[model samples]
Target: MGRNTRKRRTPLATKAIAASAALALGGGGLIWANFYASAHESNSGQNQTKAAAGQVATISCPDVGQKLTNVPQRARRAVAKELANLDKQITEAYARLASTRQAQTRDANFVQNSIVGPLKEKRAASLDRIRLDIQRVGGRVNTSGLGSLAPCTTQPADQTNAGGGQNGNGGQQQGGDQQNGDGQQQGGGDQQQGGDAGQNIGGQAGNGPVAADFVDITKVAANVQGKPQNGGQASTGSFTTKCGVNANKNHNTDNVIVAPGVTNGAHHLHDYVGNQKVDAFATNDSLIQDQTSCQNQGDLSAYYWPVVRVQDGTQDFDQNADGGGKEGNVGKILTPVQAEIKYVGNPQSKVVAMPQFLRIITGDAKTTTNGLANANAHWSCTGFEDKVQLTEQYPICPQGSNVVRTFAFQSCWDGQNIDSANHRTHVAFADPASGACGNGFKAIPQLTMRLVYEITPPTLENGQVKNAYAVDGFPEQLHKPATDHDDFIAVFKNNLANKIANCINAGKQCQ
Candidate 1:
């Protein structure tokens, strides 16, 4: 976390075509252009780029969880625990990648031999245990190819995934040493001290949230379009719940829904607004018995998301902690000014009451490497809501306006399971055109959450970002905006749940 903690790094000299301009002028405001950052030669950076052909920014491993779709229910807990271990392995490898910048510049093979190789071996061991657990429970799973996911490759800064995921529009990457945009772009970084101009505007821990990761909202054209609708009997009402925006500073780095039983599973700090007892160890029974932050005691749902930080030199309480600065996630955590939690009706059918303890995760936590497949976070500034909503680029708002993040969760359920092995698959989105649920899926009241924050906008003049802000992420993810995500657990009382269904079905909005 020190500026000169290791001197093997030369300044990151970045050259990017102004992705912001090309994106704005391209289509009817909805045209999303990819932001590609390529490493090039410059007097200050040429020697360093040769170390690994580019600074070995982070490690990219195939997402094993996305592939293990059939682990039996009896084995899910054990499988999830192993999955968390895989994330820990990646975090440890990335930490080595960041700390050994000097050694990397000396021997090009150091990374593969010293870091990646050991990582693959460790992952192979965990994967073997996972396969055994599934087999023990009579679940059909891969016994051979599963080990292939163990080998992780290093990703250069320029090749980071930045664009092309559905939110309200596209804003963030793919690979190629070739140039692809039309204008010039720069990035932001924080000097480990007073948070002024540092090495590059890449970030606080010297990884990312680069200039291309953000765009001026005023430059983006209007792109807010409604979902397709077909005439049919519809439930048009909504139910709103009042959960204060985590004023008590209920923060942690745990994710019970995904990596239960593992501490620091998230590898980044998260802000919680409801269901005070939720943590990496919380069980469904414990959740039902926990306290609530909602105004209505009947609602004890758990809602949480990654914390955003302003990289201006100040340190957080967890600066030296595991999921904090030690893992490359440093800086001050900003609390939201407003957290709007609402449930709305389906346009094509009456929504059934969601079963208590149902779990839903919207957006991909590792979208920077996972591709745009599960990316679903929408970012925009207050007054410019109708102009643009971004998935990759964080919106830079004008004075008086704060940042807004919206998550519209899946609205169709598989009718049986409350959860699945992947924490997905059991829930899904209705048809965007007709609002029809998939076969065997039942329409469920959709939850839409909007979070607002007020951090002074970072300056992006003279090719450097001062006071950059970014969401906390796994060390390897490098704080990319495309990685923003959210989680929810239904804990409503049975009577209250029925009332919600009744209200929505009757087309009556309720609070």
Candidate 2:
């Protein structure tokens, strides 16, 4: 991917595994359930078999957007919209797949002939639009490789794999250069899905959050490290910004940084904090002029992330709407009890102020199927901060302990572009070992956030997880915790920006 997504590449090969994800309902209308497994420490653990005969779990396609790194800047917006359209096509097809189970059982090729084949055709059309859009902008693109991305395939929902799930780590082992240094950087093949996405395969209709996709905090090998792992040269101060936990209830399905000007671009709900007016149509000028929810009047920055929901047979206001139940995201939205946004110092050196309107997206929303190459999910719970941190699976916290979701944005900037065609090349995560920026990259006040939610612990019934909570995401994304992500845009006034940089460098914590 672009600049290797962090200085390395995996050879641009996309393999939609043969047993990746699953579907819920089966023959005779029985529901296939998702269940958690006993913790196993090694990658060679024996898997317990649960596949019913001839069951095709879920489908996956290669991520085309990550490959469009060479699209000219002039064609980016158009290409982005087309890419969003491609994702929508997949979501719609997946919904159709979920709704038509009996048909899938009657004829083995029914899914391939009626669903996947037609989807490939639809995707091919969208791919053509992308190619033409690039050509119209005087950007040449190979036509042959683009067609290969249009095909999708089915996997039997990789259930109960041996060892540390897949790739020697818990479910959905992350690609090394993903978001932050939340845990040990896993190398080699676990980055993409093969067996992990099928662990506990439970959801609206067998989407995901596989059993192995979760872990009991008591058993996880403590992977969290103490602060400032870069040693004595680090700048160790913080500046907390008190933005109430979205009490204003600002919500939308738009992503201004990635798919601006396209309504319902996200295809999933997002709870927004800080700048009050941000949507598909928002401009830098509009953001700068809009009111903010932050206590600091000078910081109009917008922060947002996918909403988490309890799948307890309840429905929210958007239950029947497009980004909600219709797209497989059905459940009540949980407002955070505490949403603390702050700027922290670089662990290796002093930081610099960021320019206004700087945009950054941390984590990958399509991690369930797109692979964990950009995954940055840091899931934990209150009162267990020192015990462990999980990047792939969600934590089933004990009673009285609320759930915690944290986001630490990329702190190193390219010193030029505020954003990029892929929205990532201009910024990168600090090296996990050295806490230093990449070549030519400069350190900026690192943005970090913590959200706390008081949710009742989900219990196991039969093989199903009752009251299970999952993050909102694309229908094809399976609502897995691996897809959890966040976004930000710096609309801060110069004075506040300077204050943040000064406080970080001076080694003084400020509000």
Candidate 3:
């Protein structure tokens, strides 16, 4: 049987058909069927051609069923692999989205708690530092032998103040509980007083020094061709006065009045040398208590004053009064920028105006350094007549006079009976709890917002003048404050609300 067996040959025509079918259908059965067709064709001329065709057809019949099963199996495997890939891609995309959302939330929360919250707290602390530093400087005696002292210009960096700057006098302590209800229990009329000789009035009891030749806007008539200069002292046309009416009218929108004694004290420029101590101002008189009253220092001239407003049964001129409202009477303080604007008048006016600069000086040093030494060393004061080399670092009063202390001043604190320890609590004058926001201390977040906005757009709607961001809303006079602190609290709250909304709308811009 092996010797008789011959190899089966594939016909060309059948092979061509099977190869074509395989190329089109991609199945082994199709290729085999073509081969069978070719084999039947090859046997065509013989007597068994018809029988061969029948046998070839029968031989390829089973291939069709096998191809159907194999095609379906391959398709199922490919579909399963494709489905698995889709699921993995979907999972990764979802995870990435979730992570992005979480990161955004964390960032938003950090800005709110770390940046905004800390800013608010620092604003309060800064106000305290200003007041404390002023008190420390005022406590010294005029060792420089000049009638007037000078404002402190060299403010130590915050980091250097590890101790309370000078003899435990510049640190903050936990205050006691505050009073409830509107701090303005009584809204009686405060008796008006006169300004010292040459003082610029910031508050009612203007503790800051003054000069008579500083020029008065109201007194200088528009029709007058040539205005008097320095009260006709020299070639300078500066005319200064301690006019309470003009000063009051200047900062009336602030709801604060300016009087003599504080800003209008006796002005006699003197120098504070290093390594010396000056006598502290009299505690009995609130007007001359702080260096804030000093008119000149180096390139900087500070005009210090005490704010007076309604409080409880009595009236207070100094801003140290507390316990006039709930939540411990957090009184808000005005910033240096705001204060400068009120005292210096409009910057756009044709009249020559001084620069609006506010520098907050604070430190904690156990021993006195160069700047922390006596008031004489703290600053050097010069006047227009002094033939001294006008050093930019030395303090100079535009007018060569001190803001005089007057007895009849209405806004001055009743310091005749009160001492330093008790004068702060005598009466509610500038209660932080009833000031700009709702606290007496200054709120920095609100202040920053206000300043930034104003610098961008100096003009606001209506005839209202924008002073400080100490308040929240764009307009400063909207809130109905029961206490001084409410004004500032309202502003702070408004600013925060706006910031939050912006963050939500603009994604990361709020930070």
Candidate 4:
């Protein structure tokens, strides 16, 4: 065997050495490229701090065997695909992170403002989970310990288009290969549907009173100022009719003109100039007092005559204005000296169905040493002799049954606050005025009336009532006839009452 054996070819050895040398060079180059890429992308300046971190240089190598050598191309393609997937995941994570940050900021602001509660805490926890996911991905990138030339058996497939623009084998896969596609599609569809639904929701809003300048007189009667020839005493009451097309089912309210009568039976027996009384009576019988009777319509205080604000379809205000500003945004009240009532519907003099009963409480009475110093009396009059139904001035909502909720009303004298050393004393209108003993009388009847109109649940916001008044009427720009009192009151009362009722139903107690 020794005689037959020949020395191994030096040329073969040389070729083997060359191949090994080439492999070493390629491996070193690849590792260098990988490390360079990582360093360049590192947030902590990995290139500059590599020595401090005790990290070795990196190089990439492919299998040498023919069967395995085809791996570089496969590996390159896989790395590209994995990188693309990672990019997509990172993008989604970043978006989620941004949302979480925004939520956190809002929660922080809420907590600062003392608005944070259990709901806010739960939201914070959800955001924290998203943040933790971001941190976890970051940790993997920073703490991985694979060598530069190490071959990753589980390397994700590459999805890149190389020079030939060819994708890897089985790269044309579809369907389940795409992750979260179904979820994203569904989410997008739901978002669009929700937006469409929101667009369909309707609301009622106005810059100011809906019908401010409109007015109408649906009825009228002659006033002789004194006892009639038939011995029928002169009175301050009128009948009315209203008509309208309720297109939107909005609320409405109305008010009527008032004529004052004497507290005594005689037309002009005693006259008072401020605090002093006059002696003689006027024989012309042309004298008329400006007063009101039938105060406190049920639970409500009183409905104002000249100008009254009806809210949510149930309550009436003695004053021309309500507490809140135009849209009822602020909880502020301002009492106005005067107001103008505008009829809501029926611009033409069209007669509508009128209320059946008409009741008038005339302010007339006599006073004696009966200890009723600030007390006044009223006479309930029904069925006027003149059945004339001319439209100009008439009682709109006569004989309407109602209810009221009474409680202590303490308003700031200066409208600033309920408490302050400079603030004025709080007056309880329910109680008799202080110092009422010696100076004739110190108490005045402060009770008022607010009208209520019965309505169904569907009529209101899903049918809820918290306030005594309802307000309904025409739009703000419409012009109404000058003779429609009934229409105006009906609209205003319905609108105002509904608002109060809704507020009450929502757990806000009446004041």
Candidate of highest lDDT = 1
Candidate 4 per-residue lDDT, tens place, 401-461, comes to 1111111111001212111110112111111111111211111111122122232111111
lDDT by residue (1-511, candidate 2, tens digit) is: 2234442222221110111111112212323332322111112221122323334555687778877777888898899899888878887777666555567656878889998999999999999999999999899888999888999986555431221122212222222222222001111111111122322234533454445455455545555543436456676777898878987789998898888888888988999989999999999989999998988888899999999987655567876577876666766789999998888877788888987889999888876566666777777778776555565567779878988887878888888888887788888877655678777788898888888898887754334345667888887666667678899999888589988998888889899
How much is 459 displaced in model 3, in angstroms?
Answer: 3.9
By TM-score, rank the candidates, best first: 1, 2, 4, 3
TM-score, predicted candidate 4 vs. hidden true structure: 0.17
Clash count in backbone of candidate 2: 7
Taken over the whole model, the C-alpha lDDT of each candidate is: 0.70, 0.67, 0.18, 0.18
Candidate 2 local distance difference test against the native: 0.67
Q: Candidate 3's residue-wise lDDT over 119-228, tens digit each?
A: 33433343333234333544322233211111111111121111111111100010000110011211111211111111111111110001110111111111101111
- Model 2 lDDT-worst window of ten: 182-191
Alpha-carbon TM-score of each model against the true structure: 0.85, 0.83, 0.15, 0.17
lDDT of 1 by residue, 440-482 (tens): 7888988888888997887653233557688988877867787
Q: After superposition, how far is residue 206 of candidate 4 from its true place, in Å?
A: 13
Q: Model 2: how large is the Cα RMSD against the reference?
A: 9.3
